[model samples]
Target chain A: MNSVIHEKYTVAQDDFANAGKASSHIKEHLKEIGVDPQVLRRIAVACYESEINLIIHAYGGDINMDVFDDGSIQLVFKDKGPGIDDIEKAMTPGFSTASEKARSMGFGAGMGLPNIKRVSDEFDIQSSPEGTTITLLFRESK
Target chain B: MKLHELFNELNWDNLTPDVSLDKDVEGVYCGDLLSWVMGNGLPNQVWITVQGHMNIIAVAGLREFSCIVIADNASIEDTVLQKATEEGIPVFASHLPVFESAKLLIEKGV
Candidate 1:
């Protein structure tokens, strides 16, 4: 099946007030489209973690979601400059350089990327001084 | 157990009165880290946390948590409560700490 739906959402840096709005809207859209519950949950987690990462770390970013007729999902998260210095280090759980404000909001536990990678069936990442991009894929069935 | 039943059993204050309380709680997850909870919290689990903020409501909704128990009597801002109610996530306040709140849920076989 071919891709049936495409959506794009912009995320602002340090926009804690509206942090999860994009992810929530994506989840609702997937649910309405009758995506598998388990796959939907994984997509929700990955999408939300990506959104929070954009808000907490990036200067700003865009989240693009594509849903295929077979129920598979593709999420691409792209952020502006000031990208990750060490992808390996940032991938390590419990390693974080989040600011004090993010910590006070009960975030910055350093588990966002790892968790997103764990739930995603296929994950690809590329980072440089220009920006960072993470692409994640979730299959409807194992 | 159902959320209303647990709320009554714990005698906690209902912060989001407009939200429904008939949801079933299958488990208990106690964590204050929003990312950790978002990644690990299971559906229908009642989350016990000391951090009562607007983001907490978002996490609860994303994770499909049954409800949130703000343990240790944490003061939840009016805006946070309003958000929770608007999102249809029930919020409860408990005098017991996080561990104690989890213990009670365990005792109840949640």
Candidate 2:
């Protein structure tokens, strides 16, 4: 089946007040479209973690969501600059570079990227001094 | 059990009166780490935490948690309460600590 929905959301760096707005909106939209509850939960976790990463770590970023007719969802997160130094270490749980402000808000447990990968069926990431991009795929059956 | 039943039994302060407490409490998850809870907290579970901030509401809403119980008498800012109300997630204040709160819920067969 073809893609039924495509949406783009821009996130600003250190925008604590508006953090999670994009992911929340995406969850609501997917829910209203009658996405399966379990699959919706996975998407929610992955999307939210990605959103937080953009706000806390990236200069700024955009989250692009594509929902297909076959109940598969793809999310692409692209950030501006100051990319990760080591993807392998970043992928490890309990390894974080989040600021103290983010930790005070009950985040920065070093679980964001690992959790995103845990819930995603297909995950790919690339980083450099220019920026970082993370693509995630979630299918209802898988 | 439902959220209203647990709230009444625990005698906690209802911070968001406009929101409904009729949702089912399928389980209980006690965590202060927003990211940890985001990944581990189950949907419809009553989330118990001491971290009372606007971001907690976002986590609850995203995880589809039934309600939030701010344990240990943690002070919640008006902004956080307002956002929880706006998000339609019931927020409650508990005098009990996190452990006790979770224990009570387990005893109640939540």
Candidate 3:
């Protein structure tokens, strides 16, 4: 039997108050499933970064997590609004599009995507004027 | 050094009676950026920064810092202070610049 584990979170723009709750819950779920600590930390970090990106940059969006039967997890983050115009520049280590309010909140450090990339085994970002979507994959360490 | 030592060394004039410098500081982190601190900070470290925003207070709480020192005579809004005080997180202020306070704290072994 194939089992698909699913989780979803609604992210809002500049909602620092609720930021990281999604990642915290995701980490907890992974922990309950006996995911490796190191891998769990990495996944949680990426999940948090993505969730914050949606809240800080995107008008709004949803982040979802899916665990497949084969011991792998995939994260999908989708946002709608003025999408990132230049993926190249956006992915750079110190680039940020965060508002002043977001910066004041300790986000907009310009490390969001880079941090996400660092944590996930495979990462992909697709954006346009209409929306942006980030897909991340982490393989279980056997 | 223990928190009480830093309290004495820094010569903080007013630590709320309810707030206690009651723990040992493992190290110190100085950054205004929240993500950078979260990414780099180890729990139990003292966070030294000029920010007095509610978000800063919240970050320290989530990160479980030893205590937070607002530098260069900076003080957070009353709301932030109230929240911090309620969380059992000590808040201190100094007229010294961040670099100077950081040096003093490190020199004093806090």
Candidate 4:
């Protein structure tokens, strides 16, 4: 199905203050569209964790939410920063390289990526020295 | 119980009542970690934490929390208070520690 709307949000490194704004926006949009509350919460958590990762790990990134006519929502995050060296290692729970500052903020629990994967119905990630991109998909319950 | 009833019963310092006090209290959660709170918190729960950053309001908003109680008399900036008002999530303060408040809320059947 084709996307009905596409929303773009840019996240900057070390912008802890505004880390979840994009996720909040996406959640609000989904709510306004009358998405199921449980599904909305799942999306909100995944989007928030993804957004926070972009802020804490990536130098900078853009989060895009694509809403399709068939009630599926896809979130894509692309960051221009030092990409992850190992996907499998990063996916392991309790594995993190976040700084002390990020940890003190109640983040860097090493659960961000795994949590996102847990909530998302479909997840994809790709990275290189130059940048990284992560895509998360959620399908509406029948 | 509604947030206002709980606040009055507990004798908590009302930092701001601009947000709705009629919101129901589902349960209580205590933590300073923003991400953990966001991931685990449920709607209408009274979030007890020492952190007073504006993101607290944002997290409460996302999770649809009834209100926020800053334990141990943790000070919150005016900007955070303002944001709480904007988000319609009441912000309160307690001289007691988070554990004490949690116990009290549980006793009251939160």
Candidate 1, position B37, lDDT? 90
Segments of candidate 4 deviating more than 4 angstroms: none
**Alpha-carbon runs more than 4 Å astray in model 2:** none
1 or 3, which is superior by DockQ?
1
For DockQ, the strongest prediction is: 2
Residue-by-residue lDDT tens digits, candidate 4, A1-107: 99999999999998977867888889998999999998998898889888888989999899999999988999999999799999999998878898998877677
Writing each residue's lDDT as its tens digit, candidate 3 over B40-89 gives: 66667989888877666556654668888888998678776776777678
The DockQ scores of all candidates, in the order shown, are 0.85, 0.86, 0.33, 0.60
CAPRI accuracy category, model 1: high
Q: Between 2 and 4, whose DockQ is larger?
A: 2
Q: How far in Å is the alpha carbon of A133 misplaced in model 2?
A: 0.4
Put down candidate 1 lDDT per residue, B22-99, tens digits, no spaces.
999899999999889988889999999999778888889989999999999888999999999899999998899888
Better candidate by lDDT, 1 or 3: 1
Give per-candidate clash totals: 0, 0, 2, 0
Where does model 2 sit among the CAPRI classes? high
Winner on lDDT between 1 and 4 is 1
List of clashing residue pairs for candidate 2: none
- Model 2 CA lDDT for position A103: 90
TM-score on alpha carbons, each prediction: 0.97, 0.96, 0.76, 0.95
How do the residues A1-142 of candidate 1 rate in per-residue lDDT, one tens digit apiece?
6888999999999999898999999999999988888988998889999999999999989999998777788999999968999999999999898999999989899999999999999999999989999999999775
Tell how far residue A104 is off in model 1, in angstroms. 1.4
lDDT of 2 by residue, A24-128 (tens): 999999999888888889999999999999999999999999998877899999999799999999999999999999999888899999999999999999999
